[model samples]
Target chain A: MPSIRLVDVTKRFGDITALDRVNLEIEDGEYVCVLGPTGSGKTTLLRLIAGVIKPTEGEIYIDGEPASRIPPQERNAAYLPQQYALFPHMRVIDNVAFGPMAKGLSREEAYEISKRMLEMTRLAWRMNSYPHELSGGMQQRLALARALASGAELLLLDEPLGALDARLRVELRYRLRELVKDEGLTAIHVTHDQEEAMAISDRIVVLRDGRIQQEGRPIEVYREPNSIFVANFVGGANFLEGFVHRRLNGSSIIQLRGGLRVRVLDTRFNLGERVVVAIREEATGIVPSSLKSKGGRGNLLPGRVRDISFLGSVVVYEVELVNGEVLNSKVPIQMDHGRFRVGDEVLLSLNPEHLRVYPYPPIGLYRELEAV
Target chain B: MPSVRLVNVTKRYGEITAVEGINLEVEDGEYLCIIGPSGCGKTTLIKCISGIIEPTEGEIYIDGELMNGVPIQERGVGYVFQEIALFPHMDVYDNVSYGPRVKGWDASRMRRLVDEMLNMMALRDRMHDYPMELSGGARQKAAVARALSSGSLLLLLDEPLGALDVKVRIALRRELRRMVKELGLTAIHVTHDQEEAMAISDRIAVMRAGRIVEVGTPQDLYLNPRRLFTANFVGEANFMVGEVAGSSGGEVEVRVNGEPIYSVRSSLLSSGDVLDGGRVVAAIRPEFVVMEGTDGMNSGFGGLTDGCGASWGGRVRSEAFLGSMVRYEVEADNGVLVAVKLPSLSVGSGFRVGSRVTLTFPPRHVLLYPYPPEGLERAISIE
Candidate 1:
């Protein structure tokens, strides 16, 4: 078991800063995923932790010991890149045994260790097969087996599932996480996919432009993002600007720019203070319009379904409010076919608690995607 | 107004059959998407309809007129290619008006037509921009504008939004569907992505191995797919091998590994009509399976005979929180079944990876099918 720490680590390449003063601490057996868009320095962070590259500034600590002086080999960490880099000339078993044999183990001893690792990764049958003979997912499994053959406590993977298809990726991610936990190993994975990171990580570190945007548990980060970029990146949500209009009991009632008032959890803003609301598309549901408006009791806005789309598991509807602002709602696919159509009147209902009110962002919502 | 019809269309390359006997109808003002896995003959079928490759057999009709011995130009159909094959040398305005100009239209008529098409596509401001000067999305918009500006009643689109990113593709698909309806054009789109086909089209025709396996509205195909392939293709589903033990009291009970599993009686039996001792396969979508926590779990059962629908002593295998939804795998009886739930719909904290739970779903959520002639999994396995 080993804990890892990085204190204000910075890396630079001439005029460009690769990573800007990052601080991270991983517990002994935690699975942490560093997630971000491409060019967000995810690989750079992993490389620095693996001791392949030295940080321009700050300290690297491993298990309470400063690792600035230790060589890459003695760090006892294994790194797997996007592509599985197995020995082309050797069989899968030989590749997995290579790490153990390099550490002065006899041929028989190395093979014995390789057998156990292969079985753990569900690659026992493929041990005698060459890397080229295995499917994409099988080759990835072989890579994992090789990484763990060294008996390393910390495993670092950089987009290990990037090359697989959508369905295969989903299945392999769970197996990978399960294997890592079953072996009681600490894993830090890096990927650009939001779903992959959320599905497997105990904690997520979201990065943007050489800086850490947010860090927390996957559900926490997804449900309550601290920044506009984090919210938009993790899940697509519609942003609405409004101002606090009233306060009663423990809630604050806000008036949207479209002249509709909504009640939300109390915030620090004073009366008439401008704020922004973030609503997940799935959090809203639809009811037919011409129904009585349930104002003051809860949140309900009258709108007309402008468009309808079937997205497999979910049915999406683009509805235009009476004030002419369009909002998207996603509901589960109906068994009896579509329950609504284009040009139908509907009332959008969402609990006030599901409506997130935050201080108006400096970059604003429209410019967030462009900034990425 | 044009209605496209394909009667027993089949195309062969030398000795290999690229498309086999696909019979389809695209009603006037309809949007139909042909979807399947890669190498499923989707492109080959589209090519036959586009007249790029004439069918080896069968007749093609457009607006009730036979199109035999006719070229693409005479068929009066517009093709919006996925590769955005715009002329790099010409500006958007010139490119869009090229069709009418080549067809021998006057300058004033061409200008009026191109102007209206550009305005509807929101490419008027970028009309003077060249293909290289525009972004990928902009270039795609220009190509669509050019295709529609030709005044063709029928449009054949080959994955028009396939080349873009996911978010951009979704936004553009909405706009593209709206425009197609607003301009009143009949569209037949080809795509390999099931979600894209579901989102944009009025009906979907699923293909496999040069064969059109199924065709229906998105709702009909997804909720009530008759074939095993269509059940797995349209959405996420769980397949279990079982035997039809009996039916009674508005409920059909099947035996999975010698344990009775109850599904609602409203089923179209595909495997066999005999209610007793008939081998069968049951398909259930993950979203419909309901997982109740261990405490007071049995108190919910109000109307059931012989305790058939209730499955107890199930343990959670794994859990994944996928943004909009959470998926859970549970081990019950002899197999691992999945259930998908929305956080809002669940009560309190949901089941963890190792918690005990009960699994049940009404019969309407399940679809039973007879094993195909090839094998039980042949239709489900894309590989």
Candidate 2:
């Protein structure tokens, strides 16, 4: 178990800055996920911590030692890249055992350790099979088992489950987190998938333009993101431009473009201040406009259903508000039918507590939400 | 637009039969998706439809016209492959207009079509960019737009969005479907992503072991799959081995690990009558499994909570928060591992690891089937 600390780390490639003065600390046995869009410096941060690449400025400390000068092979770290290379000629058991045997353990001791790692990854049944005989999912697990059996306190995983099938990817994420927690190992995972990060990581660090935008627990970052980019990237949200109109007992009323008003559970903004209200797609509820009486207590806005997409578990309805703004509402598929058709007028309900208000950025809303 | 019909189509590569006896029909302007795991012949089936490879046996008809020896260009079919294949020397505009140009279309009409296609794919800003200058997702989107602008009445795509990011893939898949529907083109899409298939396709064909196992609407395949393989493939479902104890009034009592579990008989979507004392398997989707904390106000019997409910004690083994849903794995008292998915709104007040809970499987939600002859594990295996 080792803790990692980065002090003002910066990495530059000629005119391009890959990482810029990032400071972070990871406690022992903690699993931290670095999440970002493409070209957001996620991979660069992982490489710097893995000792594969040195930072251009500042220092990196692993287990309370200066690790910038250390080479990758001597860092007591196992780096599993996106494309894992397994020994084709060796069996699954031998592939995992090779790591321990190279550490000068006896053959029996190495095999014992390898067996336990395989069991944890659900690969023990295929221990006698060659790498070529296993599926893509099995090969990934084998690579992880090999890394774990290497006795490295720190594991750097770069999109370990990128190549898996959709269903297998979901199943493996659970197993991966369980193995890391059970072994009490420190892990830093880098991926462009927001859902994967939210599902497995104890803490998520959102990166953008070679810098850290926000860092917190998965739920905190998802529920209350500090910036518009973090909120949109982690989980897609419906954005509405509004201004603080009035304050009501720790809550604030926001006025929209068409003079429509909505209530939010926030009072940090002053009256008449411009702000944007963000609501999660799933948090928004929808009902037919004819049933206006059923809209009990909440902010109900009249809209027409423009489109509906059934995503198996949930249905996403795109409703065009009377002001011509489109809001998406995700509803679970509970019954067989009775879903709103495309032309039906509907009422969108936004609970005050679910709406998060943020001050308008210097740049426009679209520019601030851009992933690039 | 033309309808496509494949009658007893089979493709063989010496000793290996890639696809066998695949009979499928695509109605005019219908959007059908063929989905399966790798090596399940989904790709091979799409290739056969695209006329890239001649089937070893059977007949293919486009608009009731025989197409046994017709060339791909004469078929009037647009093909988009999983792999990137764009003209290297041409820019995005030229590549999208290639098909219309070859057909001797006028400049103004061709330009209008190309512009519309580019705008729909969000590649208008990159119209002058070459394939090498675009990102992976953008290149794939361009490839799709090129195929759509070709004026082909039939479209056959093999995992067109497989290489895109998750967010991009979701957005592009919806756009792709909308364009196909608006243009009134009959399409057959092949992919391994079940969610993508469910989201866009008018009908889904579940392929397995070089054969079309079942074909139905997305809702039918997901809720009332005729085969156990489809239930395991389309979504997450928990299966328990049991023996049928008795049946009455559409409800069957199954003995799972010596505990009585009630399930719906008609939910099996089968014809045969279930015999008592016969081995059976109970399947339930995670969303249908109701889990309640034991410390809550109401307490019921450990065995049966009501007339149609079967309750059991369990301990939460693990929990995964998946944005909209919270999935929990529980170890039941009968030694069966059950998965339950609840809306994430209840996450804060939900059961945690090692919390004792009551898992209730409503009879209406439980599906019953005769234990697969090949065993439950083999029956549910995708490979």
Any runs in candidate 2 off by more than 4 Å, and if so which? A69-71, A105-138, A247-249, A293-297, A335-337, B266-273, B297-308
Query: Each prediction's DockQ?
Result: 0.39, 0.49
Number of clashing pairs per prediction, in order? 2, 0
lDDT of 1 by residue, B1-383 (tens): 99989999988889989789989999999999998766678888887778888899999889999886789888888898889989999999999999999999999999999999898888898999999998778888888888898889888999898676556667778778888899899999998667888889999999988999999999888888878888877777888777788888756777887766677633567435536877777778777666677875431222332344546457888887778777788888556565545443343345678888877755666677775668776668553
- Model 1 chain A poorest 10 in a row by lDDT: A163-172
Clash count (model 1, backbone only): 2
How does chain A of every candidate compare to the true chain A by TM-score? 0.88, 0.90
Strongest candidate by lDDT: 2
Window of ten residues with lowest summed lDDT in model 2 chain A:
A330-339
